[model samples]
Target: MEVRMLPEPHTVESYRRSVLGLVTALPAETVGLAEGLGRTTAEAVTAAFAVPRFDNAAMDGYAVRAADLEGASPESPAVLVRLEPSRAGSPQPRPLRTGEARPVMTGAPLPPGADLVVPVERTTSGRFDDGATVALWRDAKPHIRNRGEDIAEGAPIVRRGVVLGPRDLGLLAATGHTVVRVHRAPRVALVVTGDELFSDAGPRAGIPDSNSVYLRAAVTALGGDVVSVQLVRDDEDALRRVLDSAARKADLIVSTGGVGPGTHDLAGRLAAASPDGTLARVAMRPGRPQAHGRWRGTPWLALPGTPAAAFVSFEAFVRPVLARLAGALTGGEPASETVSVGWPGRAGAVRFVPLAVEADADAIAVHPLGSPDHASHSLSAMFRAPLIAMVGAETANVETGQLVPVFEPA
Candidate 1:
């Protein structure tokens, strides 16, 4: 096997922009409101009915006319007759008559002809009872929650590109929406390459294929689904076959391993052969060798075989692409915090060092979890790390107590 030549390294920003530019969101799909949580809205969802649906009481109190309680106070309370009680989800009570008050539980529909709610505590009827007449100590204004107050009918409750959450699901369901139209999660094919990789509990000769575990979790956490995960030998024929099938079935193809310059690195050879492929060395530590190409109109990305390198590369490149394909707004940079840290740095390449973050009352301190080179290959350390500090390429050395931007993993 001949050594594959790597194209000159591209700046991380430029490379990310290039790769992400080629990918787009998948087709939209309608799913039940329960299943729509964490999915991006394909279009604006308008409320069919008001959020509350009907006017209801905002508190547990007596639903009465504000005029009936006028001039009522603790020293001189207004005596009013009590009507049938109303509780949440129960039938609406009868309208309040002159000199009458109706006991209402929290969230009960406010009856017509009633505009105020005198809290039970403010009246001589300390709590609900068969009291003939209760004394209203203080004049209470209407505590009724009006219809369309939370959400107006036909108003947009959720906008496009917004990811649904727990509260979002409730709002949609409350607004009489049984189903929601959301951007379908992009189907990703994991074309992991390694002849010695095994899925068994333990590998006799080769290392266990562990990248798939984290990669799969990462994909699902980012709102994408892994359509298939295929492990192939370090041979051109086997890799090409998997890539071909994955390209046809998946929206994105991600391959790990077989991108190096070794004799068995056929992934690089195949990627280099593609018409639009660019096998470039990225200007970064740990994850430098990478390949990007198009196979049968499907975009393919290849990362180095090492677990640490693959994960770091995934965070640096694949994350934003997945976000874009999931219809998430991918404009701004990653959310980062400035923390005090001192670690090794590379002068010519950007460094991503995982840090165990600790926050004081007003200051955040970050410490390197393991070797800054990530060569230790400690999976536990990676899991424990909450932040990855991005030291710029020009940064030669990170001094103690210096503030550095760090990113938390998803």
Candidate 2:
């Protein structure tokens, strides 16, 4: 196979759009609410019933007509005969009489003809008992929680393409939803290619294969199911076989290593030879050599061999595509943070500087862990920093106290 020359490097924004354009949302599947966490909804979910199904008491008090305590006070109290007690989960009590009061507990359905609830503390006899005379010192406001106050019946509970969280599940449960329809998680296949890598525990001549572990964990954390993880040597024929097998088993194929310009970069060579693939450099620090396109009818992303570059490329490119396939709608822009210290940047390449974030009530700031140029071998620094600061390609250096876009590490 003939090796194609690498094309001009694409900007981060243009490359992201190119990859995302090729993705289509996965099919929807019905799942129980118990298994719905982190799943993206395929359709909008509306409330089956109104929240607070019925008008209920907001406090433990006496259900009474506001007019009864019109002139009530401590010295000249309004004495009213108490009827039956009203507890939560019990049948609705009879309509409150004009000169009578019914003792009520919190969350109990309000009695008919009662317009106000006088807290028990404001009454002389602060007790829930039948046939008792209670003296109210002052008039109290109606402490009733109205039906549909929180969410009205048939109102939208969650919009389409929303990732279900713990609170979302609780709301769905409370709104009478036992099952939800959500997009299926995308199936991913990982290919870690290299000849100088070893997976054994003992000291070996080759470096330990950390890419397999990192890529697997990253794919899982992004809601993609890792179907297979294959480590292939630096051989074109062997790489082709693994790619063919991976295409059949996964929706997307992610390969770490062997995408650089080195002669032993078999992944990059094969990817460039494909009729539908594009192998180009990305204008970014640490991760410049990148290849992506369809291979054997499966989407393929070939990343650099360097650990830091692989990580940065995955977060910048693969993550959004996976989210799209899972039907998740994410924010367009990343949140920004102020820099606590100055850092140098690449002249014509975008800089993804690993940072240790410090957030407080006063301000949120970021401290650079290490130099961006040396990020390829700074795996320890990457581990210490959970956030990546994005500096524009036009900027040569970021000054202290400057705001920069920041994103979470995958």
Candidate 3:
């Protein structure tokens, strides 16, 4: 296979667009609520009823009439006829008439005609003594909670395409949604190719083939519903057979390694396996070399094999493709975030750099990954890198402190 090169390197935006354009061909799907986290919402979910479903008290106190409290103060206190036993979630025994007070518990409904709630501490305490009577002071504004105060029954609770987080889950549950409808996680197939790679550590010279494992985890983290990860030697026949077969069961096909120029590079061929226009090599750096089209009608990305290189490419390219497949908005749309450069930078073409960010009241600062050499010896700075600093080729030289747009995480 001939490695295709462009006269001017492709921009990061160009590559992101390339990947997303391909994935969008595949439409969104619906999945169950049990596994909806990280997936996007296909449709809007409005509340079935009010959040509280009824008026409820904000604090524990006695429900009373404000009229009786007129002229009542520290010097002189207003007295009321104390109604018996009010508990939370229970309806009032009877409506209180003017000048009557109800002993209401926290969260209990206020009696009719009662206009105020006086906490026990705020009011004078009364007790049942021998043949007893008590002096209970009642003075305060209406503490009643009106119906539909918390939330209206038909209010728009959650919108479409919003990624469901833990808090979103609680909101759904509160809305009486035991099962939710969300965009299904796209299923993926990961194939890593390398004759030199090893998966065991028996005093072996080669490390375990981690790119596939990493790719698998990355796919899951990006809202992949189902994934198939496997190793393939640098043989065209073996790779072709496995990838083509996996494509049938998955919506996306991801291959690491064999994307670069070498005697064994097989990324393009695998992507081109299908009759559809699914494979094409793009020009760029590190992960610039890619092939996408379709195998068994499923969108696919053939990624480079370099661990760090493959990772950078995936975040820049592959992940976005997955998002598009799952109906996520990305790449300079209303959903993307912007930031200021924290380091000097430049890219011969579009470049995706590992980034760390610190936010302040005014703006956010971007810390590009130290040079590749800096990352190998110290993995701490590179692992779980959350930012994608997108720099274009037109940037002659990027100086520190310049504002730049960043690809926000999934």
Candidate 4:
């Protein structure tokens, strides 16, 4: 038997870049505004019409010409004939003739020839409807919301590559967009390999499978569609069959377990056999071993079997790649935060520590939830963490109040 040499380990940043390079943006698909939340815009969406489509009242008041209210005061008020009331969504009322006032509700279209609105609070009759002769206490400034004041017609409403949120969808809807064009959600297939996970002998015999649950929820939260989730034993043939099937059905295949350099590590063995595959260690704690490459023209990322490692691996590598494939602008970098407590770091490897973040008006401080060693199997500790602090390899120890790069889990 010939001996095989392992490839040199890659820096955490470099490995992430390599993984991202494996896939491209998916094609665009049209979706209704109601279904556009969390989807990435395929192209810049321009406003079909101006916001506040017509000149309208900004508040509930009487619409009248500014000249008509001139010299009006509380002691000696100007009395005008009240015309028909204008409520929002109602047809436009007759124009405001000189010395004529119209009761206009908030958002109601301003009648032509009206230049200002006197709030009801300023008039003797504070109510919306009371007497035909309305007395204005003082001259009021124009309170009309002009058409296109909030958003211009044909102007960009949402830029391309932006992930649509509730506010974004609302903006689009307000701008006369019933439907939006967004990138197709990437379809992912998960393959979990481990005989222990499916043992019928109960918890005493083997541990319950948490990777599948975590991965499924994470993928969906990030706008990925999980097409299939398969659980297979440690058998090589079984794993291969599942993988081949997954590749045919999914845009990306994510496999957990069987990625280490062990005899039962079928995922690593198969990756080594592929022409474009790479099986290398990254200079990061918890999730250092990574196998990524294309299989059957579809991208495949093999993560470690340890639950914590798998979780961290997905966050550091898969999340960004999935976002990119969905046509979202790449999040440039993990934000920096100050660690509230000190934590141990690996000598030559970057440490990823699960942390619970506390935010106050002044600043955000992070506290570690896992062990100082950043063990790969500490899934329970990581469950309580909302953030992952990236400690540099050069730093053997992280001092309290030290600033470190942090990633928010999806």
Candidate 5:
């Protein structure tokens, strides 16, 4: 019998740098506001016109000249003749002379020469009607939203590298933007290896391949397009064919399973045979066996076959690369939240644990969901967790109530 040994595992940071170094932002494309949700801006979006576009009333009120309502109060009111009501989208009413008032609905353009607005509630009339005159108890307070108050004309509404959200879209639309230039989602090719992994099979038969389902959703959430998903049955030729075909259609390639030193583990072997591929053990439990290289100029990443390992590796390593390719401003770090540890665990190497976080009094408490060991780890329980707790590689043990880093799956 012959024995084979792999080299020392690369540090997590070193592996991440290697993977991110090979990725670049995808090309920019124009997308309408409806389609730009969660897309990263390729350039700063400048406002074509100021928010509000013109001075407008902020509430349903009476637009009046402040000079006309001097000394007006609940005890003694000011009587002013009302002109036509000024509704939104109607042309701005003609300039108001002294002793004149106009019913201004919320968002209605302030009539010219009207310096202030008194809420209809504060006036004798609770609602605006075609009234001949109205009595105002409180003096006008000028409840007007001025032009450019929220955003200035020609000013940047959204900066480059920003991910567009619902509020961002609303602001852009308010600033008169119909379409925006955004970095296109990077197309990803998923290659799953191993003959035993099946998508539909009883537990007694073989393990279910749930990686594809979660990986596809994760890729889409991270702003990457899954162009191809290939399952190879521990065959060198099949892996090669899929890689070759995937390279032609994808910007990046991700393979799950068959990365170990076993004879049936053909994924690592095929990748090592590539023109620019190398197999290395990363310094992390569960996901230490990793393969990286370029297949037809597209970056390829291989993760451990286990569901827990694949999920953790995607969050720690693959997700940052996707963010880079998608033009998100992650700075090589996954989105994280501070959490207090509730249990102790082994932490010689960087460890990732699916965690369920809860609010405990004034602090956030995190409970590790399942075992860290690859075989005993629970995939079903992990799905219920909202966060992944990352134990530092140098920290030997996690102390109770100690603050730790928790990451939300993108």
Candidate 6:
């Protein structure tokens, strides 16, 4: 077997495109409004009706003509003819002449001739007592709720390629769309490499294969269904056969482990079994051994064996491709942030240190991975933190307050 090495290391932008084009052509699915949350909209949606549907009152005040309070003063007030109380959803409020006023509540439709709403606080409380109108305490401007002021009928409520969040669901419901068409979630197969990797409770020896479940959950968060997570040893033949079967069954193939430079080269053979597989070197420390390629038009994301490496590679590369393939916007790298940290500066490659983060006026601090043996015990505690200070290539040494890129953990 011929095994080759890459001459140079690759950055996030280097192979970003290689994996995105792998599986961009998938079918879309139509789901109901209840299930559309978090799904990407396939087509642009237009509003069938205006946002308010009618001119409604913003306050519980009296509706009157804009010119009704002309010459009304605090000491010598103008008392207009009063009418019955008009609440919200009232179709017809009694029209008012130049000196006429009516009692109106909040959200009530303005009458045909009513052009202004004077708040009750600005007028006497006894406005509707004994067939007489209250005197104006103070003059108020016209407070009319204009039709289509929020959104016009047939307006574009949501554009195509927008991921539906909670706000989007309300907007769609307001636009009278009970159902929406979204990009269907592609079924995926998570192939865990390394004979030393054990993920299930049935195992007692090798390290627990946490990467399988982690990667599976990551894919799920991006709207992909990891229907099966299969673990394979460093055996090349077994991996090839499994990958071939996966290409036939799964729409996406994500393999974690066995992409590093070592004797056990399972990812390379699995790549060859693919229709047109390729491998590249990632520059970062944790996920530097990451490899990317394709299998029968389906993309193959080959991550490193280390837990941290696999996660960084997936966050740096794989998840973006999956989001785009699912019709979500993902043309760029992960949301990078500037943070501060100190490193030994001996290791050559760029390293990603996962730590708990808190915001201060100056910069973020790098927390110790928190007792390597008990990291899982306090994972949630670390997650509350938001920043991970990054060290660059030219950096040989770092200080406590130096600003660096603070990466967000998924």
User: Where in model 5 is the C-alpha error above 4 Å?
Assistant: 1-6, 71-76, 122-131, 137-140, 201-204, 331-347, 359-364, 372-376
Q: What TM-score would every model get versus the actual structure?
A: 0.90, 0.92, 0.83, 0.93, 0.90, 0.82
**Model 2 segments beyond 4 Å from truth?**
79-81, 130-133, 358-365
Compose the digit string of candidate 5's lDDT tens values, residues 173-247. 989999999999889999998888887655567777888888998998877899988777887787889999999
Q: Against the hidden true structure, what lDDT does model 2 obtain? A: 0.85
Residues 264-367, model 1: lDDT tens digits: 88787677677567677888877888888888888888888888888888888888888788787763465555545576666888887778878789966768
How much is 373 displaced in model 3, in angstroms?
Answer: 8.9
Worst 10 residues of 3 by lDDT: 126-135
3 versus 4: better lDDT goes to:
4
Query: lDDT ranking from best to worst?
Result: 2, 4, 5, 1, 6, 3
Which one wins on TM-score?
Answer: 4
TM-score for model 2? Answer: 0.92
Q: What number of backbone clashes does candidate 3 have, counting pairs of residues 3 or more apart or in separate chains?
A: 5
- lDDT tens string, model 3, 1-410? 45443345455566667667666624556555666677777778887777676555556666766667777765577666666757886865677776666667667876776767776666555333222222445544456676678777878877876778888877777777776776557888888888889877677766578787778887877778555777888898898788778887888888887765567877665565544433344444446666666766777777777676677677777876777777666433422334454444444655555577787999776666566223323334446567655555566455666665566544
The residue-by-residue lDDT of candidate 4 on 302-326, one tens digit each, is 8988888998899888998899999
Candidate 3 runs further than 4 Å off: 1-9, 24-34, 126-140, 205-207, 273-283, 329-347, 356-368, 372-381, 384-386, 407-410
Per-model RMSD to reference: 2.6, 2.3, 4.1, 2.3, 3.0, 4.2
Model 6 spans > 4 angstroms off: 1-8, 44-46, 74-84, 92-100, 126-138, 153-157, 175-177, 234-241, 261-263, 332-341, 346-348, 359-385, 399-401
Better of 1 and 2 by lDDT: 2
Tens-digit per-residue lDDT, 128-150, candidate 2: 54446888754446798888999
Clash pairs (backbone) in predicted model 6:
198-209, 337-406, 338-404, 339-404
